[model samples]
Target: MEKISSTKNSKVKEWVKLKTNNGRKKFKKFLLEGRHPVETALEQATEYEFLIVQEDFDLGELAEQVDNDKLILVTKEVANHISDTVHDQGIFLIGYINEEDWQFPDDLSGKWLVLDNVQDPGNIGTMVRTADAAGFTGVVFGDGTADFYNPKILRAMQGSQYHLQLKRLNLEKWIRNCKDQGSVIFGSILDENARDYRKIDVPDQFSLIMGNEGNGMSERLIEMTDMNLYIPIKGSAESLNVAVAAGVLMFGLAG
Candidate 1:
């Protein structure tokens, strides 16, 4: 295995650059930290560039899975420099980002969770994990939504990202495509005029839109949805968190 002991190594510097969005865009790759995510990525057969580990860290069976040429042994200092977390896991993987053009499917089916201008990485990741748990086909990141590859989101999602399709798309065009395909589009809002989610029948093929954390759904999006839904708050809370609201609505509608 190629051993990198210096934090100032040319390769180490390039890997550190992946911490930013622009660097990831330029390099066309992102870093995966810790064990579970790296393990999941390997298990899913994700295309990867390298499997880097601290010299003393035990790889056990994992070592056998990685090609000899793709494995790199790094010193603890190098590992710390590459880590995004405070307490480093000492294991990491460099994964190639998918750059394929994603288009709306000709036939829309199954449940899809759409985010409109949702910027919080944690919230977006949580909703995606919840959607995966609810058996939704995928989650769409609309304009203004945080990048899926954001390190924080990648951690929050754990391994659920491998279980479902994820896409970045223009919600307006996507919604219109769903409408043309006869799939019901549901918008979540805080408006009293919207129907209570519990009272609505769940459709097998539908798209659910959860909007910005503070500003609810965009008015134009709300106008485009087949129906708008709101969850009744029996407590003193002003409103439910977007992720929590999405979970309730996704599972409720899934049934």
Candidate 2:
């Protein structure tokens, strides 16, 4: 393992760049934060790049659980220099992220959730974490969505991204391809034309389409859905947070 102590190092600059969409694309890596998520990656360490921890943070039980050779120890100043969050856990990991090489299951026939342009890393991560819990086939992220490799997204995903097939796709080509696969597309909406999400028989072979928090589903996606569905709200909050709505929908549709 390598130890880096300088905050001004070039590799540290590159890791900071990985925080952004363009940098992740250029470098082919993403940052992972917190002990839980780092443990998740280390669970599959053979596939991961390396752990980046600060001089000050605890390695947790991971020191006994994982190989020490896989870790990249750096100074606390180096961690603060590269982290997006102010409250640093003093530990971050650089996982190999490939935006262009998602390998889907050959028999991917089941419930799925499609993200249109979910900008919030928290929302993206929560949905993914729950999606993993509920056993959806996978998640397909369309253009304009937050960087899937963002540290926050990875952290929020809680390592569930490692378990499921995650695809970054061009909306048109993806939808067209999925049509042949046995995926019936369901779009979440509020319009009267939409049916209560619980009423429909969520196709065992389909993807539920969700869009931006404020805009709802895209017009094009709505037109393509086998059905439009909405959760019946008992409370009056205008609408559910995208992440919350997704968890409710995923359970209802797939559970």
Candidate 3:
């Protein structure tokens, strides 16, 4: 319900700061950008802390649907300072920082996903969305993975983050833990040892690991997996994008 006209205002400065990891950490929130992403966040996120809007942008019906106490009206120029995209989508949301650590269970009894250094935010986000739709229990981000809160990732996910059990993990340690639990870990790779994706006897509850964009899963992580699986491309393309690979595995095998 607070209206901020001054782009240089202290509060506006704080919102601008949310663009960075340190700032996001300190404030415990991130700016949810783009119309669809913001709308998805509004529906799934528990708290509606702030809705920043440009004065001329009509939120007409949307304004009525939101919690009135949490809205903030700002000038278009004022809002552009905090927006990651050049053309503002007329609205963005400030969502609560998720500080919760979804610990890896000792049993590894549930379906899960392990992303190892998949640096592309779009790929990572799409993987998360795929995992959610496929009924996977959670997605674990290994060291060197993209920041899940990165604007591109958030936008691509369309706000799927809130419902998923997410964790940034020490992959080697996490893999070792799962190994003892009868959980089969599949690494996406192109090695001679790699089996056609469908030929692998994927356990009912296991983890699928997607690795870096250029390099597939790390050597050590591949060793940690029960086996390696690859999509047999009839074409000559050397590799698939990590996210696209994940989507194929998720929907093809798991769906």
Candidate 4:
């Protein structure tokens, strides 16, 4: 194992690149900050690219659990340089990006969450996490959604990504495919014509499309859905946050 004290070290700079999506794509890797995400990675048996830690962070029993060959000790300055959060736990793991193509499951009896143009990283991550909690099969990230490896998104996910399938595909294609697979696709929209979410009966298997934060679902996708459902708000709020709305719908429809 190597001890790196300089932030200017080549290996340190390479790790820093994992902070950006483009950089992550170029390198085919991403960084998981702190213990929880790293613990999830370990539980999933994700291949270790590097296990970096500050000099003072005692490995304790954890040192025996992980591959010592991949371990690197770094100075406090170097740890700060690679970390995105102001208060990082002084430990991080470099893990490969999940680039495998996720096929539509042969048995389409499971619930699915489709995110269309949801730009907020926290919202995107929270929805993914909620989808996992609601027993959804997977999440399809449509075009214009935040990159899966964005730091804030990863932080928000809290390692739930390991528990569910995530894929990026065109929403139109996904919608058509879901229809062809005998799966009911419900679109969440705010239009006057949309049925109140409470009126719709939850099915054993379905695809729920949550759309952009500001504009709601696009017209083209809306037209393709079997039904457009809306959460009726009795309160004065203009609309529920996309993630919050998704939690309500996922639990109501998939729970």
Point to the candidate with the largest lDDT.
1
Clashing pairs in 4: none
Worst 10 residues of 4 by lDDT: 99-108
Q: Identify the superior model by lDDT, candidate 1 or candidate 3.
A: 1
TM-score of each: 0.95, 0.89, 0.90, 0.94
lDDT of each: 0.90, 0.78, 0.80, 0.85
Provide the global lDDT of candidate 1 against the true structure.
Answer: 0.90
Candidates 3 and 4 compared: the better one by TM-score is 4
lDDT string, candidate 4, 164-238, tens digits? 888877888887777787889999997657898888777777889999999988889889999999888888889
Candidates, ranked, lDDT: 1, 4, 3, 2
Candidate 2 Cα outliers beyond 4 Å, as residue runs = 56-61, 64-70, 99-105
lDDT score, residue 109, model 2? 78
Q: What range of 10 consecutive residues in model 3 has the weakest lDDT sum?
A: 98-107
- What is the overall TM-score of model 4 with all chains considered together? 0.94
Clashing pairs in 3: none
Candidate 3: where are CA atoms >4 Å away?
105-107
For candidate 1, the C-alpha RMSD (Å) to the true structure equals 1.5
Tell me the tens digit of each residue's lDDT in model 2 across 131-236. Answer: 8998887888888788678777877787788888788876666666678786777788876567998677655688878899888877887787677888877777
